[model samples]
Structure formats: structure tokens, C-alpha cells
Target: MNFDDLRTGSAVHQFPGVLLGHNVRIFHPHLVNLYGCAIGDDSRIGTFVEVQKGAVIGARCKVSSHSFICEGVHIDDEVFIGHGVMFTNDARPRATNDDGSPQSEADWKVELTRVKRRASIGSNATVVCGVTIGEGALVGAGAVVTRDVPDFSIVAGVPARVIGDTRQPVSKAELTA
Candidate 1:
């Protein structure tokens, strides 16, 4: 729902610094800091889901508990972010900025995290920003995604590589969702 309509409640608990659009429903135990982020209606950001500033989350998406949507992230509609999934914008982040000053908004490189429609990032997966996860692709849990994932393919590993296709889940790559 709209930002003004957001009130402090137990079921739909929201913290400060969060910026939500109209008709959006946050499920129980969901906590988000409003910081000028845009989220469309009918999207479900579950418990422990954190959407940072400058993030644009589309409508009708399911962001599972413990998921991290960092700054500059852009997620399209009807997508899924499983539990504990994280998106990183900085390729080589330092403790401070190049000038040796404490990290601040000015220090941010402003990288982009783009998740196309219908793509699903599995639990505990880490997606490196500046890379696009193709439509309908699946990122397996515990995977470290460092490259562009193809459409409808499945990837899992330290440097996540396409190992199978989610279109045929019951086949060789019968991994858990």
C-alpha cells in the first residue's frame, strides 16, 4: 500500500526508511526500512526480507523470509526470492571509499541488480550485481553466482554454473526448490 497508509502493526510490521507503493501487502513478521524504494502492488515481501534504498520490486512477486535486496536492485513482476537469498552490488567493495573515508551514500558505486520476470533465486544463494538472471532461470541455494544465467536454466556452485534446466526439475537436476 501507499507510504502514508503504513502503520505500526504486528502482522504487517514495517520499520522506518521504507518506501512502499499502493496496494502492497507485507505478510507477517516482514520488516523493511523505507528509503525511497519503489514496490508495486500485490507483491509479498515475507519475513526477514530486507529491501534497501533505490530498489524497485515489481508487483505479484514472492520474496521469501531472510532475503536481502540491496540498493540498485531491480526485480520484475512474478519473480521469487527464496529464503536467505542475497544480492551484492559491489564487485570489489572496500571498508571505505577510494578517498579512505568511511563508507557513505556518496561512496556507493551505484551498481545494478536486475532480476527479470519469472526468475527464481533459490534459498541461500548469492547473486553478484551488474549481472542479469534471465527470465525463468533458477539459481540454486548456496550457489555463488558470478556470471549471467541463461533463461530457464539451473545453476548451483561456488561460482554458479548452469548445470541443468529448471523446466525439467525431475530430470537429472532433481534438486530441492
Candidate 2:
């Protein structure tokens, strides 16, 4: 189904539900388990990006191919989610909830996942739930992020830490297209 038809705003647009925002662009074959989802303008959800319910992607964001933005993740503007990056919002997960029904909002402890503006998460990175990746933070490739990433910090490794400051001047290689 085309999301352009049912796009509505405010954080939680559901599956078979509305997905509204300014200039929202979703690549084809995107599998979204929709519920409570909102995306700001000029945002690109690349192929294979599954945006679960309650996932808010802000303006000018690029969610790369094969990435998973799970429920309750709030991604700010100009963020780059590299290919295969995964964001999980639930600390505890169960296959099924009580009453023998599949898990819903009530089943898991849903914590807020916020990725601030201009932060770049490298390819194949995993962002665990309830952690705030601060503005302009850089998470290296294949990193498993558990703790919070401070603003302008560069982190690499399992359970990411402050390895360096990314606020320095950009080199020619970094600056060049």
C-alpha cells in the first residue's frame, strides 16, 4: 500500500495506518509494521527499512538500506543511519503477551530512544533502547551501543564509549564529496 495516501502526523501512525509528514520519501518494498509512526520532511527510508510503530524520524534524515528503526525511536533531523543499522526500543521482549495474544504496546517496557541531530551511525551498528545518542555524535561501524553518546562524541566498540571528540575541523577527505 502507498503511504502517501494515508499519511498523518503526530508520533504514532499505525500499520495499515497513516504516515504523514512533509516530503516523506519511502523506497519501495519497505516493510513497515505500522502503528504510531511519524516522519518529517525530506526524510528517506531506504529499501528494506522497517519502521515500526511509534517511530519518529525527523526532517532531512537518511535511513539507509536494510536498517530497522524499531518502535519508540525518535530520530532527529539530518541523521544518517547507515546500512544495516538497527534500533531497538524494548528492553524486554516476549514472543507473546498474556491472553495468548502477540505482544503489543502493553507487553514490553517501552523506553524512549532518541537520536539527536546530525548524528551518524555507521553501517551494521546496533543501538539498544533507552539510550540517547546526543547531537552530532558519531558511532563507528559494527558498534553495539548500550550507553549514552554525548554530543559531538565519537564512539567505537561494544557498549560504546567516548573515544574522541568529533567537533574538530573536517579534513579534505571528509569534506570532499
Candidate 3:
């Protein structure tokens, strides 16, 4: 049976020759086409997700539905990207340059956004360009992240602010004390 024959609720739009690793699961294969992107092993991509050219998603990541992973985005291993998440790569966004002409590839620069290992981005979060989300950080839902987030920090709200820190793993002796 073909992909169209599968009786799923939605269809995935996977572009030909997407570099998907072993054991990857794409629910709506017809709704996403990751031609130039590279998804690592054991990753799961939900419906309506679009991973643009040159984007790299590391191993064991979960990218939820309606998320847009644009070019210049690099997500490390074990990351959790929630639903409706948006990643931007252009800081100075404009239709035209100083010459008043339409912008071309050479006229703009693509800033890199890096999500470090084990970070969790909540639903509807908008991550701006040129920011580093540190390892194990938790970004709360609906947060607009505009700066670097420290490791194990929890951030929320517009232009996201650090609200708390993630609990570090404690040994049995420390827990008893």
C-alpha cells in the first residue's frame, strides 16, 4: 500500500531525498517536506511541520505539529519542540534594502539560532534569531525568546524572562540529607 492508502487523519508532505535517520516517525508525511534539512536518528516529526533548507535536528528530538524550523537553525540532541513553535533566522527583516530594491539572497544575512541539547520549548513559543537556548532549559508556552537562555533555566513571557531553574539531579545520599 502507498502513503495515500494509509487511513491517517492527515497526510505528510515530505520532499524527496530528505536526510532522515533511522527510526524516524513522521505522522503527517504529506504535510511536511524537508528537502534540505537533516533529522537525526529516532526523531519524531508531527503533522504540518516545515523544516527549511540547511536546518539540522539532532537525535531523539520531538518536533510537534505546526512548527516551522527555518534555515540556519541547529537543534541539538534530545530536544523537545512543542506545537506551533516558530524559529526565525533573519534579524533585520525588510522587504527592501538601502537601495529601495527587492531583497535578494546576497542582500540579506541569515543569523544562526542554536537550541542546545535537551532543551524543551513549550507550545507556541517564538524563538528569535542569533540566540542560544542552553542545554536542559525549559521555555514556557507562548514565550517569545529574544536572548540567550542559561542551562537548566526556565523562561516565560514575551521577550522571555527567566522565571525559575530546573532541578538538578540529586544523588541518593544528597536526597537523604
Candidate 4:
């Protein structure tokens, strides 16, 4: 939606240049820094979150508190971003140029990271740039995702490795024993 269609006055004092869909809820508006991003319908953004420009959060998604969703990151529908999760856009970040001058936006390229539908990223996860988190995938807490995760897979640990498939259900006998 356009700027004019955005919620006015007290309802959106902290949010500027944000394209918010109908029923989008941002808890503690004063505590979050959301700018130039599009949040789809029925999405909930928690406190202390910063959703940067060019970031798109899909419908029915829940972004927990203290998370950082940087530019060029696209999260699909039904996604769950847990508390303190961080997303990076630049692979090689530099403070200054070859001439020792301060680096600008044009100095570095922003790599895109896509979280496919139904993915759940647990608390304190760090998702590196240019990787697609497959649909229905589960990224365990404190995971440092450096590669693409397969669909319905459970990934954990630094440099996140696939531990199991969600589709494979544990037998009742195993549960009883």
C-alpha cells in the first residue's frame, strides 16, 4: 500500500515510510525501528526489532523481540522469527574503501536472503546472506546458518547442519520406551 493508506497520527508515530498491510500489529511501536519495509496482513512485530529498508515480511508471520531484519531479506508467509535473530545482507562488510575513505551504500553489494513459507527460525539465530531457507524448515536456537536448508529439515548448531526431517514422525513404541 501507499503512504497515504498508512495508519495515521498516534497509531504510527514511530513507523515512517512503512507499507503496512491490514491488521498488521507492531508491539511497542516506540521500541522498534521499522523503515521503508512492507509488512503483510496479520503479521506481528515484537519490541526492539529493526526491520530495515527493502525488507519484506509476509502475511501471518511473527517476528519476536530484539530481531534485526536487514535489507534485501524476504520472509515468506507463515514464517516464525524468534527473539534476537539476526539477518545479514552483506557478505563482505568493510568500514572504509581502498582510499581509506568511509564506505557508502554503493561501496558494497547487498546479498539477498529468502526464508521460504512455513520456516521457523529459533531464538538467537544468525542467517547469513544469499541463502534460501526452504519451506517448513526448522532452524534451531543459536544456529549460524551459512547455507541453504532443505525443506522440512531440522537444523542446529553453528554453520547449521541438518539433524532430522520433520516429516519423519517418531514411532509410538519409541516414545513409550
Best by lDDT: 4
What's the TM-score of every candidate structure? 0.81, 0.78, 0.85, 0.89
Which of the two candidates, 1 or 2, achieves a greater TM-score against the reference? 1
> By TM-score, how accurate is candidate 4?
0.89
For candidate 2, report its TM-score: 0.78
Estimate, for each residue in 53-159, the C-alpha lDDT of model 3 and write its tens digit: 88988889999999999999999989999999999999999999888999998877899999999999999999999999999999988999999999998888887
Number of backbone collisions per candidate: 8, 13, 10, 0
Candidate 2 lDDT tens digits, 75-167? 988999999999887787888876788987666898899999999999999999999999999998888999899999888877676677787
Model 1 Cα lDDT, one tens digit per residue, 1-177: 234543333333344545455556676543544455667667777876777777878867888888888898899878999999999988778788768888876676877878888999989999998899988998888998888998888888889988887677455435532
Candidate 1 — worst ten consecutive residues by lDDT sum?
A: 5-14
The collision pairs in model 1 are 1-23, 1-24, 17-33, 17-34, 17-35, 18-33, 18-34, 19-34
lDDT for each candidate structure: 0.77, 0.79, 0.84, 0.88
Model 4, 32-91: lDDT tens digits are: 999888887788999999999999988889999999999999999899999999999999
Best by TM-score: 4
Which residue pairs come into collision in candidate 3?
11-30, 12-28, 12-29, 12-30, 12-31, 13-29, 13-30, 13-31, 13-32, 15-33
Clashes of 3: 10
Q: Roughly what TM-score does model 3 have, to 2 decimal places?
A: 0.85
